[model samples]
Target: MSKDYPALTRDIAQYTGELRKLVPETMHSFYALSRAAGANGRIDAKTKELIALAIGITQRCDGCIGFHIKALHGMGASREEVAEVAAMSIYMGGGPALMYAADALRAFDQFDVPAV
Candidate 1:
């Protein structure tokens, strides 16, 4: 069955907020690190999000895919761009990655932000 990307994102955010409250210092540090890692550097944020999406696919992490797809959609990534990234993820990770890559593409297409 297809997942609901927007609802998944909202749930993640709500759960994460509660987790943050439960472990304020730890969650704060993790959030700080996440922001730092996602900051634009040699690679632009768009490319970085693509890379993250690929990693998410390769790792088979649904939450990771949702987050990265949302970020990619927000950054105005094209469907073609997402497809190319998914291709690379499949190349690197083989069969298991294929499943998550499909999921990632679906998430990208269903995200609230439009693809370019």
Candidate 2:
């Protein structure tokens, strides 16, 4: 069997809602601290998101990568941008990076941001 993403699936809405409940509070904690460190004044939001994506990949958190990539696009990151940033994770993480990057890439479609 072959697997691909950006396709229709079952049970996604439940998972999506569940993710919403957990992710917002966790993301806000980081966001609050980032702002407290004057990160709000220094780093742009998109860049921060890319940084988060990289970190998620490094940590091998499939959920983090998936959610952050979705968040990145929601913040206006493009597919090429996501692809570009995730590529660097390749050097930092090796094969695991490539694999997880694709998982993150799926967020682009799964989140209804439309493919770019």
Candidate 3:
């Protein structure tokens, strides 16, 4: 079955916000780490996002797939680029990764429309 990626990300965001309220310090630190890891150093932000998306697919995390695909879309990542990453994930992660990689591509297509 097809997934509602936008709704999935939105629901995750709402719950994440709630978690932030419950564990402010831990969540703040995690956000800080995310920012630091995602920041451009030698690699560009788009590349970093691509790598993250690939990892997400390999790990089979639906939330990661949705969020990273959304971010990649906002960063102007073409479908070709995401497809390449999906291929790489499938290569490394085998059958399970293939499943999530397809889902990642679906997420990318879902976000291809105007930003919600």
Candidate 2 worst ten-residue window by lDDT: 1-10
Each prediction's RMSD over C-alphas, in Å, is 2.6, 5.4, 1.1
Best by TM-score: 3
Per-residue lDDT value at 25 in model 1: 97
TM-score for each predicted model, relative to the true structure: 0.92, 0.64, 0.96
lDDT of 1 by residue, 1-116 (tens): 88877788889999999998999999999989988888999988888888888988999989999998888777888888999999999999999999999998888778855545
Candidate that beats the other on TM-score, 2 or 3, i.e. the better one: 3
After TM-score superposition, the amount by which residue 77's alpha carbon in candidate 3 deviates from its true location, in angstroms, is 0.4
* lDDT against true structure, model 3: 0.94
Clashes of each: 0, 0, 0
Per-residue lDDT of candidate 2, residues 2-110 (tens digit): 2233342224546656766889787568657856653444787778878888888877876566657666766878888887887888789999888877776776656
Give the TM-score comparing model 2 with the true structure, all chains together.
0.64
Q: Tell me model 2's lDDT, rounded to 2 decimals.
A: 0.69
lDDT of 3 by residue, 61-96 (tens): 999999999998889899999999999999999999
Computed on alpha carbons, the lDDT of every model, listed in order, comes to 0.88, 0.69, 0.94
Better of 1 and 2 by TM-score: 1
- Whole-model lDDT for model 1 versus the true structure? 0.88
After superposition, which runs of candidate 3 have C-alpha atoms over 4 Å from their true positions? none
